[model samples]
Target: MVHQIRPRNSASASMASRKISSMLPSLMRQVIVAFIVGVLAACASRAPAPAPGAPAAQEPAPVRLGPLGGPLAVPGTLSQYRSHWVPVAWEELPGWQDDALHEAWEAWLRNCERPAPAFAPLCPEARRLSIASEEEQRAWMQERLRPYRIESADGNANGLLTSYFEPELQAARVRGDGYEVPLYAPPPGLPARQPWYTREQIETRPEVQAQLAARVIAWVRDPIEALVLHIQGTGRLRVQEADGSTRLVRVAFAGTNNQPYQSVGKWLLERGLVRDATWPGISAWAQANPDRVQEMLWANPRYVFFREEPLDALAADAGPRGAQGVPLTPGRSIAVDRSSIPYGTPVWLASDGPSAHLARLVMAQDTGSAIVGAVRADYFAGSGEAAGELAGRLKQNLRLWALWPRQ
Candidate 1:
């Protein structure tokens, strides 16, 4: 945003003028200035007068300033599948000055690891500026990038914001001690890009169960937790191995059944079985109707399988790998409509609702089936129960601005 530094206040200017006048005391100097002024006035009067019908001289046009007092830039256009970019001043972005950009620098660094073609050339400078002061970083951005307001093809700028998070659950390497619900890796001989089996079929059909038995990576106590993990696509498991040792591991998304996803809570609501559809509400309903929990789960035909990865100390702190193949930075990574905002693009996100009041820099590092509109985004709230609570309740208004290189 253009932040013009206004001239000094009239009172301050007047005071400074008086102070300078006091410094110039010699009457001879005053006489010399008066003589010079008289000569200039006489010269102007003696100059040839304009002829009749001659054009008068005009004042120069005012200069327009851009962000940080730079020359105003010509707006540029960029096209996408479901959205279009319209150039906007950096000042147009909501809360642009309020955000702590240094907090987002880590995520930007991650984006550099697998940057989009347009951003690759800027990485070295970005890395060098990592430790720079916020003002310096802001100045660098103003000099190098342009902000574009993202809008729908038909010109709508408003969109919905929802959230998702990585689930963390207690589990076991074996199927005993109430840890009966098994999470699987992709089934052997599972056909690619084709419908395999529905959730119900996978659970009920003996042959299908037989094939999946050897694929169970870990077993959790609650079927609902397993379902949550499936819907979330990745999670951390604190597992008790048969050797009586405990270890933390990540189960990242591997593949999903080709069948369409159905929302279990929506199914319950349609059937008049529950009043609220949030995850906590769904869990409450399950607890109240334990006998029908399996039936509720089968409402969603789609299932996601996972591949296990070891989580060392450093890996444990980082989020799951996103579509961009970088570990997401909590509160600074988002899943967007890839067609609208390409992977690795930096975005200015602003949203206000019961769950969060956010105006920050976030990287478009992931995508989801439900995230398919110009302004729509699925915020990654990080891992564990606290993040899950926020994700479950976040459904609000959203606006986005993409930061692109000027060149």
Candidate 2:
């Protein structure tokens, strides 16, 4: 009975099951295809198509200010503004709007007196704008000036900044009342092309004294004070006359004796005579060791000659006249390497350190023998004792941007 049941519909059932198995694979394929189409539709809806036109070219990189490490970015379109100079916007100049630009205007007028060839054309406008306010001045500069980042020959913008100032000292017309040291004018015997008596010969030699005797402009009590005048190249003398009257006069740099300049403070520092080799420190060491004063002076062979110049109201108010033949304005004037920054060039300076934070517009109205580099400058602090203190302490990292007229 079991054999007869098994035989019934066995072949037909097997064929039907085989047919269903073949169809099942096709059904699964269709389901997977439908799911993939739905997923693609959802993705297309989520993300909008890009614009029809070609993609825009990438914008240029921002200008580099040089952070703590180095230049953080590239300066685009700046090199195109000037040859061998990089252009910058007013925003690049730190504290640009905050400063009292009137003070700088006064200095700019002084620059107009003997403007650089590039700037000479703008001098007339500069004079007209003298009475303008800070905002107006800034606008005037923006209209006429193009700021150029001062780069070294090797393309470095970083540099060193030092400072100098006028010094005031007590002086006497005659060698009496303990004022024995004499400041002399350029003597006829010392030819311009020849080296003259050094600090040693000028002080001790009778012949040197004879040569300089009639040329004496004024006398000072301390040898250190006399040295300071030589170091400063000019000084304000409070001269007490034989008539017991006192008057203020300026002694300007007539000439140098053609000898090499040396630093007594450096000499002392090399020998470890003082902890700090500033003028005050040198003076303190001198008080402690009076016997070595002559030795300290002889270390500097260079001698500076001066002429007695009467100070007018303008001259009295201004700093010493620089190589540019214009009286320098304190905090607005700088002594740059004439080769790097020509006389009458306007410079936007930036510097910050533990001692001072400096950012301003300054004129390259002055020069110094020591200020010899592509980016070196000696900042003119001011006149008198307070100015001296500031100048002596000023040595910092610097950056410069020359404000030239647009070509």
Candidate 3:
């Protein structure tokens, strides 16, 4: 749902500049903490596992643990891209031998649908390996590809991992009976690159309303949920149609109003309305200040519209199509900074945190407005309430390695 088509020239540069400028205040606050975390994480890079029967130590080592609870470390040679690429041994990746790579193979197949130039030649072998044994697949990878640690241009490997999911909500074809918030399709004759009416304008002005009247794809019960759907860029709707029949459909991101996106949670925080800006916190504030719900929502001028598509059996089995123009594999897809990691690349990801400890292979299949920087990524956690909950709570430390075919 967070997939976006980003400009590659001046517009993107301007956006990046604005984003960095706006983040200065918060970045300044975390400088010290980030430094400490960076230092600890650097010491643990590309490490190897300890022997199986090794005796327990008095104090747990600072080594990063693999999925199977093995210590990892190995020195690597540094090269450069938009991010630094430090060549490392296959054994350097945590849990390299233990991952259920068959699960990730599906994502790789999807990547073959529109393979990057560098990856197009390898797609044939990748397809052949789909049904190969894990041992055979791992052997082929070691022989054909090289692993490189993905880090910032300055060589720092630690990064942030957040997540996003396709939300599932109930809707009504005709608005009413508590389903007053409308999820829209793009207004007719809307031009790209030009700013449209703001969120407040769309909500409060009759002229704007008239323009969007026929564009209502469906109406949902909660304004907050509608906003969430908008922010995530897509969602699944259990729609009660005018015919009084219920059917599940997906609302995919169609276009936006071209206004700058403002975080309503940030707005609340700035106004001293709430200390926590997460979804739960925002919901709490809305409940306590019901009279100001519209004001809170309008804090974000940007508006996303969606187009409804039927959720057939095939489509229902897969996640939404990413920016790569391929269906994303639930836990095996991640939105990466294309500037750092190109789309269709196979990546090894490791993260240890409260929400989840993950060590697996995932494809760089998507991108987002906030998923900037060399090391940053947004893990696609799939759809429904469980995925949404995981997505909402997952913000943690991350490390990455790109597996590229050797020339």
Candidate 4:
């Protein structure tokens, strides 16, 4: 989670100082490849029949193909409190026609599953648009949904849009095979609001470990992997059971220790140990200062526990269910603060800044502690390592428009 909240006075300056994750593009591509292979393997047993006239050997492509090409832009209007929809024409939304609306249709339908009163009216229209032309769909949306730009009451139009993803990891049912670190369920009697054992105590304290003696959901080798799974709040675990067979399962967020969350990147930067506070930078620093690994992990006292969820072909095909009780659509789902934009709202998001540029339709199906304010959003990029790298690096000025049902 990003520690720095946007200060009111220097919104632009605050973003400028934020370090983009330094993971190499080639490495990110490789991570995506690994993730694709894993997905295919999980789906191999339940292969779907090819559609008529489709390539016989072709498999379904993963959601969200790659990194942002460059800057995405179009004419947009900004104003204080609220921006008038009257002056904003459909033509103002950049790349509206280019985006594969069908790809986001699943997310829209997911919204309808727990439909907000306002979106309920548009449900029938959204379903039939799968076969419609992009232009036709655009016109349909214009009639069905109204878009209004948002700014903070203090008049800040520029907000932050970062991203998040589910990580995939190899794990074990038993403590053998170098998989020593155990992810636990909340130990019995840990108070909901009280801070439990810190990360350090979880590591070193015998008494604390006793409470979790048999509470190993799965065992992962790297402490870093454990920390990452904890941070992402959900992940796919390729667990090998003692029977010498393996099946994949999701380790989902259960509860937190109520301790303060701190960014490991910030820890390195504060000590003048690194210039760029990204994953690669952190890994490089760890390599150099191997002894300080414990110290770094201790910086954040918060500990997250997990519960094992059985994964099937369908569950494996899609992402973990978000707080909205629906599977998240990789590119189109965003986590937002409920107070500003209610869950199930469709939002038009665009950004053009020194670091990144994007424009797309997203569903506000999830929320995070760090995701606050009228205009802020956390874009769900995709799953696995590449997605996480992009999520960490994504700190850019954002423009937003909430697409509410037309009156």
After superposition on all C-alphas, the RMSD of every candidate to the true structure, in Å, is 24.0, 34.0, 10.4, 13.1
Give the candidate number with the greatest lDDT. Answer: 3
lDDT of each: 0.69, 0.65, 0.71, 0.63
List of clashing residue pairs for candidate 2: none
lDDT of 1 by residue, 1-407 (tens): 00000000000000001112222223322321121111110000011244578566333223333332222332322332446666776766777776899999999999999988888889999999999988888899877887877777677777877777776878899877766778889888778799888888887889988999899898876555565676677889999999999999998877777776665556777997766554345545655776666676676677777799999997777888888888898899998877778889899988876557888899999887667788888888888767766665566788888887875
Q: Which candidate achieves the best TM-score against the true structure?
A: 3
Compute the lDDT of residue 144 as modeled in candidate 1: 89
lDDT of 4 by residue, 1-407 (tens): 22112110000000001112221244653342222111110000111243478544322222211121100121111211122222143444555556777677788989988887667778888878867777787788877765655556555556767666777878898886566667888788878887777777776788988998877687876666666567667778988989989988987877776777676656777999877654446556766776666677677677777788888987676777776777888889988766666678888777764435567788988877767877688787667776765655566667776776644
Name model 3 segments beyond 4 Å from true.
1-46, 50-81, 278-284
- What lDDT is reached at residue 288 by model 2? 69
Q: Rank by TM-score, descending? A: 3, 1, 2, 4
Where does candidate 3 clash, by residue pair? 46-73, 46-74, 47-72, 47-73, 47-74, 48-72, 48-73
Residues 1-407 of candidate 2: C-alpha lDDT, one tens digit per residue: 00000110000000101111222123332321121111110000011233368475333234444422122232322222211345666555666667788888889999888776778889888888888888898898887776666677567777777777676878899987766678888888567868777767776788887887799887776565565567667779999988989988988877766777665656787899977654346545655676666676687777777788788765678887888988899899998766566688888888775446787889989877667676677888777766765665566678887776755
Cα TM-score per model: 0.79, 0.77, 0.82, 0.77
Query: Which residue pairs in candidate 4 collide?
Result: none
**What is the per-residue lDDT of model 3 for residues 1-407, given as tens digits with 9 covering 90 to 100?**
45421110001000101111222223221321121111122122345675588665233124332332212232121122367666776766888888998999999999999998778888899999999999998898888877878777666889988777776878899977866778888898887999988878877788998998888888876655565577677779999989999999998888887888765555777998876554345545655666676676676778887888888987796888888889989999999887778788899998887778789999999988778878888898888767766665667788998887775
